[model samples]
Target: MIDFCNVSKVFNTDLLKKDFHALKSVTFNIPEGKTIGFLGANGAGKTTSLKIAMDFIRPTSGEIKYNESLGKNKLEAFKNIGYLPERPFFYPHLTGLEFCHYMGALTDLSKAEIESQVNVWAIKFKIDFALNRHIKNYSKGMLQRIGFLATLLHNPKLIILDEPLAGLDPIGRKELKDIIVQLRDEGKTVFFSSHIISDVEEICDSVIFLKDGEVVFNGSVDQIMKDNIKPETRISYFDGDSLLTEVIPNNKKEEYLSKLLKDGKEIVSLQAEKPTLEEIFYNVKKN
Candidate 1:
């Protein structure tokens, strides 16, 4: 668990350009054992925020607070964190298994522990068969899979992933999403940044939506949807050989449905019009 309070970051560019404000007093919380999605478009400060959270870069102002459960100090607490950057560096010559071992060693995991973990997760990640092949020979999806294996090698309490689903095919994305759900099931805290709104909506309990370096929304997915719900009902009906669809305001829905029923039209389906996360994101951005 972590609390990012009013964090801001500014980058100074050369000569003619003005200082860039990558983050503008952003604030959000990563609750313990929750899958928190960082949702934003490109150049929207998602990566900057993650980097600041990881302490890879210092914020220009404000502070990030870690729960004592993380550790007594920063160094000790960081040991319990597993991070996968958007573009992770890999040794081209090293085989997948070798690469995982190298990463595990950095976390001070024993060789036996590393081996056992690799054996278990490799099978789950569907990369077991290719573990002995050089990473250079692996495809992009394969590389992402290996990177994930390495990240989980230590079983960190908090997993921080930047664009973890980037560049993967649909099947690969689904596989990785399944792995993330598995991690959440195991009660691990996952804070991942992604531009993919639908994927975030699928697996995340809560989300932090950013726009142009500002915090637009931060809370439960259900709450946001509820807040922006459309006050309309959509109905489908069959009349003789034809099917008709209608959108009615909530106040008039019952009256409209009664008339359709009185007309002897067969009602096929009726439901409230709900906005998707994508729609909500765009609406928020536009406003």
Candidate 2:
């Protein structure tokens, strides 16, 4: 729902030190109703890009164009965006329900509307049982869950999550990922940043990879995986009550499979090896 066109950001420091280039002519599109993963390692400008998109930090050069669907003006558009920062601060003394109410009030939501949204989302997020408990008593995952519930209280069309999965346990990660997918199914545009490639690969329909303040790759996840498929195939077969596994070159796979079949070996399984997103990410960094 947003187009980042040739965006660049520079942080000027002391005269003795050089300016830091946080982003270098980065360009990408967050299409409507799609779950887009902003992938990058630490200090790779992922956060900078999101900040620019949110208008939290101005880009030194270039601009971000919001689709008219967001609103006619910037203020109206921003109202339609739900954002959760990487290190969100919450009132330690406020209970979860109270926190949600406070956030909803900022969004101009009425008390009744806030209460209704919280009732639905808190249950779905699995944090409803603890809504009356103090925030300081919540675990890391619980904090993240409450943060998300608060973000969605307004039902924004576009949800921008900065490192949403960071510091989450495996179960926490899975729960958040499932929520992201649910948002997609409900036709919400989600652009989330993360250094975790496996989590992104599992849930993102498409991904934008940033390396050193540059856009390295931006396209469909399936297409990228297909393009980076390994040039070998793995096979498993039962031979004399023993299972044998082998990896063969793509060119020799057919020949090898034929030989095994001709020899009466029971073929157990055949799989074409493919590079994981992590592998591809390392390769991108090396390049």
Candidate 3:
């Protein structure tokens, strides 16, 4: 688990020049064993928060604590964390297997352990056949898969993935989602950033929405949807071979239904359109 307490990051580090506040007193907690999505538009500080959490960059005015009982040593905590950046760089000359072995060594895994773990993840990601190929020859999807495999090779307790599904095809995305679900089932915590709202909706138990370098929302996805539910329900009916539709406030549904029946219009269908994550995201951003 991790906590960001009043965290703020200012780029340019100067008062005279135009300074950019990447994070504005952001505060949140990442609970254990939960898949959390960091959602934001460009320049919303999603990546900045993740970088601060990972200690890639120091926060300007706040503290990030990870499992306080584990002590204040960041490297000790990082040993249990696996991270994949948005655009992962790979060794061009190393084959996939060679790269995995190289990274696995950094985690202090034995050669046998590295090979076994790599094999398991390779099969899971369907990249077994390509492991012998050179990294420079990999396509975007293949590179992403290899990068993902490297991230999981050590089986870290917490996985931090930045845009894990970026550039992946539909199948690749589905495969990654399935793997993420498996990790969650196995009780591993997953924190990821994504531009794809639908994927976040499908995979994240909780989501954090950022706007203008601030936290706009942070809670369960279901609760956010419920809180932002649309106030109107739509009704469709037929009036002498002509179809007509009406949007009525939720409280007036019964009244409108009664009026439609009294008017002698044959009811075609009646349904309430649920608010989607995308709609809720835009609404939050607009506000």
Candidate 4:
């Protein structure tokens, strides 16, 4: 398991003479074998949290700790981790195969092992053909595929991806989503950030919604869907003669709402009044 203890981050801008609190006292957790979707708007400090967990950047004040020291080896912590940045920087001149090989080498894998693993994932992602082409010629989706293969070559237990579905066609998006589910089923912990709600809804077992620099919610997707904390529901009938008060009574609002929709009995409109992640984030900011 990973823990973020009162983690906070601030950035200083020389021109403005002001500080930007990218994250403020943000804390959350990712239990093993679970898929967590970090949902938020742009500049929500999701990236900062991921970076801190990976040790890419030290927290401004707080610390990130693990359950067991993965030995005294610093890189060993990475042994169980695979990371893909929001926009992964690649050596443009290197071919896709070369890049994977390089990452494998950095992880201290044998050359033969790199070749074997790279071939497996590269084939699965259908990027084997592009493996020989220079990365400069790769499209955004292609680059993401390459980055994914490189990250998975070591078979890490934890995978952290940032906006991985950013620039892909519909088919590609579906394929990657399937891959994420496959990994989760294999008992690997998957953590990623995305602005795509449908994707989050589809693959994530739970989510951590962030705004500005704080965590607003951390729980299962079902909890957000039920929205029991602030219960609300909408109902409408097709008949113009039907009065609003008759179709919707405050006392029976939620119960009748579901019953009417499912029974398909002349219901003109229906809406579940649960707050979306976006709404929740804005509400948190508002408070």
Model 1 Cα lDDT, one tens digit per residue, 142-204: 888899999999999999999999988999999999999999999999999999999999999
Worst 10 residues of 4 by lDDT: 240-249
lDDT of each: 0.93, 0.93, 0.90, 0.83
Candidate 4 structure quality by residue, lDDT tens digits, 88-185: 76999999989988999998899999999988888888899999999999988898899998989888888999998877899889988998999999
The best-first sequence of candidates by TM-score reads: 2, 1, 3, 4
lDDT of 2 by residue, 65-164 (tens): 9889999888888878999999676899999999999999999999999999999999888999999999999988888899999999999999999999
- Runs of candidate 2 with Cα error greater than 4 angstroms are 240-242
What TM-score quantifies how close candidate 1 is to the native fold?
Answer: 0.95
Local lDDT at 252 for model 1: 98
| Model 1 backbone overlap count | 0
Q: Which stretches of candidate 1 lie over 4 Å from their true place?
A: 240-244
State in Å the error of residue 221, model 3.
0.3
Better of 2 and 3 by lDDT: 2
Model 1: which ten-residue window has the lowest total lDDT?
Answer: 81-90
